[model samples]
Target: MSTPAAAAVSSADGVAWDLADLYAGPADPQLDADIARAGERATEFRNRYEGRVAELDAPAMRDALAELEDLSQLADRPLIFAHLLHAADSSDPANGALVARTAEANSQVRAGLLFFELEWLALPDDHTEPIITDPAAGRFAHFLRKGLAFRPHVLDRPVEEALEQKSNTGSRAFKRLFDEITSGLECDVELPSGPQRLNESATLALLHDHDREVRRAAARALTVTLRSNSKVLTYIFNVLLQDHNVDDQLRSRGHPMQARNLANEISQESVDALIDACAGANGMVQRYYRLKTRLLGLEKLYDYDRYAPLEQQDGRWSWDRCRQMVTDSYAAFDPRAGEVVEMFFEHSWIDAELRNGKRGGAFSAGGPADAHPYILCNYTDRARDVMTVAHELGHGIHQYLARDVGYLQSHTPLTMAETASVFGEMIVFYRLLEGSRDAGERLSLLAGKIEDSFATVFRQIVLTQFERAAHAARRSEGELSTERIGELWMDANAPMHGDVVELTPDYESWWSYIPHFIHTPFYTYAYSFGHLLVLALYATYRRQGPDFVPGYLEMLRRGGSASPRDLVAPLGVDLDDPRLWQRGLALIGDMIDEAEALAAGRD
Candidate 1:
């Protein structure tokens, strides 16, 4: 089987990311010097342009922006490295200290620049509009729009600074507390061999275990552990909710999700349309589960069975084979994409090995605007691992193309950021399907891809629905008991999964572990939106051939410079049309139909 050790490092054409590019080690002298320099630059900027932004000419403003961007780019390395290292080994005290120090320094630097935008906002439209109209400033239109959107939300300078200063002690402190408590919990579960202690990563790994009893035990242990700490989790929820409510009230936000939508730069209608479409596809997900039940020879699938491997006894891919497979798949899609994926393999940009204290899951960190993006994954050399490599490499290439836009516009909003990743997966999956000669192998691949779509689209919708209900219920009825929160979760998920899957009673506590609900409320819908959007985009690509790449690259190149509507409009895709989402859902339904047909033919 694909073992943790095999994924420790990547090798392609003898190149690697050389994280040493950021720092020789955590204690490198350059890191310390960079931190000191960032502080000095922040103070220098404050003294030079804090209150005089309105008086500056276009050239002078551009110079000031360049300086700010340079400082931000310098700070990026230390901050990203610190956080990445900490995530890889949260129990390491040294890394933890590094992360804390970096955060404090970065916060100070950010506080110094707060007045730059605020002062610009204070300017008359005549002064601001001309600057915004200038070709040089055109790239910053979205950034400017984002600042203006928060004009009403901006408090007076003193109030804003005070709030920022107290943030670490308030909401931030509770966040850390929640993380520590959750990460440190060790659940004892009975395995086939014997009882064992389950850590955060191990608990998730159980969901893929072949033995049904092992998966069930793991699920039970997780629920029981979470249940034991529900009160503390509830308090964390209360503090974060109240914190947001107070801020929203002070800022006069129309609704709880208004600020989030503003930050995402997506319209409320767009999100609603996506959610409604996914809810309409609930029947499809249920149908897929029924198919899964018949394949597993079970009367009813359970929650734990949702992620069970399609072929329980299948051999795992060796790390080398996994890398080759992913790169080959990419080459089949586009030579340019294959080159980007190859760069990641050769450059050691990926840290794919699983280890003790290493963070669970995978993420692509956008590197310095001037540098390459870095990917971290706890790869197990499974098919999913290869797909993840493809997924992250997509983000890397997107970042590479976007860097041409310069620092200010290189960052895409979270809503559209998943586009390249999901599209990459589609490319790889299609390549696999076409190359497979055996019907069984093709059916397995199709099932895997459909399950991934369900996880990203359907699962996220359920989470968003659960968060909406939980937040509203909390506001109207006071703090939710652990039982009440579980009920809300089941309400959202049970119907989506249907009668083919039996949700264990303890699955209610599953809501407590979702970091997105706490970190970014209502953020789950973005995944669904991105998945559907990519499905549509991929379909268009298949029909249009080579013509689609330029349009696809152009969309990524826009970064956060335009609205989602404008970004997709060039390709003749409309985000406002609910039918587009339904179209995406229909594609997934079609795949499920194919899988069922193949299965029936086998019987």
Candidate 2:
């Protein structure tokens, strides 16, 4: 049942990541050894520092931070391995069990360490400030300073430990089940070759098919499957929404995203500004789709048609080609980044094959600082697939470079995390667009870039808005029915498309399949924040050319060592200015302007 596109992309079928660096497999004795050792260390840590955080001097605090970092790595190693295994194939009962066991273990270690943070939070600002500023504290200064932001939300040690322990069976269980159900879904699509059962990722990729009928069938197939599973999925969302609401209440957050914003090291006003800027430019979305409609010679565009190729001869690149293209793009930008991208392939660090139970979407996991990061993606040989590689490699490069910052401080907040990834995509995209052989190819490439940006910027806002609505509705109206949730999804999405695209009834159930709502509430806005920030950063790079390279890499190297504002200020970008966000949006507008001119044969 493999299509020509599928057959052509078979090079990726052999590209599974080698996780030996973490452990040989589930049976590896080192996994248990590490877990047990971490538990013992956690106990010793509690015995030594549980009630002593406030009394520790700068040097002692520095030593304590180093011990905690090592403890975190030991705990994270097995948990991350289990997560990667489960993401690869959740259908395996052992994989699911491993996930559960490691999660419980992680929670136990975190619970035992709860008193350290609570006692630290108890210190007066005068007592903590000098210690935070001490050079002896080293990179732990930012780590300690960041902890103070959560002081207002810290609960009693017993209460904190109780909540952490209970979550494994509560919200965590729901999230695992949601992943299992969604990843195992099979959509029956009636292709010209007859009915074919496709996994969630393959089925979703069909929306970009050159054939309208195939796209229609794929859309219907997805809706049918989602509707069949809507009850459990809707129940999952409701439970998670309530769980989030309870957490919000316990943490004393005023709004649904307040905690998320705080965790992102950003303020509510800044998120609002990013949302407002994207929402204001929604006209650009409608305009681009209208242009697509004309280009496709269709009387009306639908949700499915939004991603259709403008021509039949869509480019397809094999795995090797994609590897070369991405590395070349990065190398052209900076030789050092290019070397990191090459290392991902030379070493078995990327899992980019199509497997039955593999998770949909893509992510770069910073597995263990002692080892290295890993990338998970489904590469289908489409042109966009090339950009996907570039995107994830961007994250891989960022994660690889940030390892020197240590485990606790290496990972950036969600808002700034997408910077390197989006910047990587931009470079690859411009490379492809510049090399286009004709006006038609240029138009297609330009349109694809614009849509990708829209997906990251405008569509993410719609998702965040839908999350806000669902959260508010759950608070006010109790558990929402599937139909009620679908209405909210449509309301949030319809504004972006305006009258340009027709959203059929089948599109209603589509929201149920998104993992973000169930796994991480309000996580979508980070995409918007990162995309806009990168657009502005990419602009700075274009202006300064080679000079921007060192500062940008250094920013990634610093990782979460400082606030996001401090991290990017050296690059000449301000996180606070709404005008900066609009500048990014203006770049998207310029893209549309170029696409329109190309379509009119003016290029």
Candidate 3:
């Protein structure tokens, strides 16, 4: 959820989630006991099932799968708690230690279960197909079919186990290092209020301030701070890049993106089309920015001014107002969607407090199947914060509906995961648009929506290109230095803005702040995937009206039980059609046109 600007700042103060429902703290004895229980179950399951997958009948296989799910639920409790703690404050050594310990324990547990997947991969289709096809297996059938997707990439059991074991001290360690480094950073910038120091999140919020000078200083503060730290961040990127490439090469993956496509259960062809279509539509983005240049009264829109608010709306939303706006919008869409939003607020399932050491960005994380999803966002009282509330609660509601499907099937792919969240934002956005009585408010709403669409749709696709180039360069050209990586970043970025906006060298280092490049290579495209998918789906909602509600709900409830193609096909979505993507991008273009029309009248 890391964006060009931080999602973790607020003009309005605080409300933190009560983790007591999961565990009071890392010190909770229940957390320790759950870890031990999961470990013991993992060992027993391994002893009973290892080397026996092919011999198991359909009934036995169902029981074995259920046992694995139980073990996963146990492991998730402490794992999620540790994650929440570290997210709340990455600088705390105790939180860091627990996160490390949780990773180690979860890895070991997963290692013990590794034999099941490897043996399943070894099973002939003739032997395995009938078992998964059985109606009694429920959603597990879809789960098994999806697991078979990695058949080409799965290694020998020992090799798979070794990778899992090494990942704790390897990839996981690097992620912790990244979190600590970024969270520990502070920006010193002069403001109208005089000299002020802020964390990455707060400092980034300044970039959106109405004052151009304040925005300029915030941008400079960010560039100078990140540039000074580039040496270390660059090293982190290099190691992470090499680590992924080596793993992919070992697995006989054809390209860096093959693994992601396979994991997403999507075909490579579909992904290729997506990247190409978005790149083609990048011209619309350039056109929109040219409009922005006039609105901002700038000869050229610099990177700092890219997200500058067109005009500030006076007043701020209180926390209660955020909750009410989001929940009411969801309810307006459907009572079922609203129920989940209510549950999150009523049950303390969100962490919206502004804190010094908390991480930047926003995300909705699901717990074990029976528990509620938890949202993490830094709520500033800006109008955008209202949209953020709607967006994440969309995810929270999705997780809630998907939960009863069981753990393995409940997790959606990266692309489908954004559907509910984006859709939720649309509901609130349209509500706001409808309620605005005057052109100025309408212009503000339209501008904000268009800006967000650019970030989620166009900008993310560009980052995907940057990631592709960086990974390829690292593989072929040896380790990439800060300068080289920055060059690759700018090379991918400059084309989208064309001559309308400037992509300076300072903005190059901005790439270092994105957690996605290190956390999940080739992951940025999912933002584009989900955004476009939802826009297309939302179009249908407008056309079909209430008829669309049931189909949409069914799609969310299906969760990861089916592949992205299967899940959306029932909703009449032809994902492979380039027209769908074009349609979505055109929606953004329409917004730009509207803004241009409004601006002309204002003159």
Q: What order do you get sorting by TM-score, best first?
A: 2, 3, 1
Per-residue lDDT of 535 in model 1: 91
**Model 3 lDDT-worst window of ten:** 1-10
**Cα deviation in Å at residue 339, candidate 3?**
2.0
Q: On residues 259-284, what C-alpha lDDT tens digit does candidate 1 reach at each position?
A: 87888887788788788878877899
Indicate which candidate wins on TM-score: 2
Residue 121 displacement in candidate 2 (angstroms): 0.8
What clash pairs does model 2 have? none
Q: Residues 74-177, candidate 3, lDDT per residue (tens digit)?
A: 98889898998899888789999998898889998998888898998888889879988887666588888888878888888888899999998897788779
Please provide TM-scores, in order, for all candidate models, with all chains considered together. Answer: 0.93, 0.98, 0.97
Number of backbone-clashing residue pairs for each candidate, in the order shown: 6, 0, 1
Residue 311 in candidate 2, Cα distance off native in Å: 1.6
Q: Runs in model 3 with CA error above 4 Å?
A: 1-12
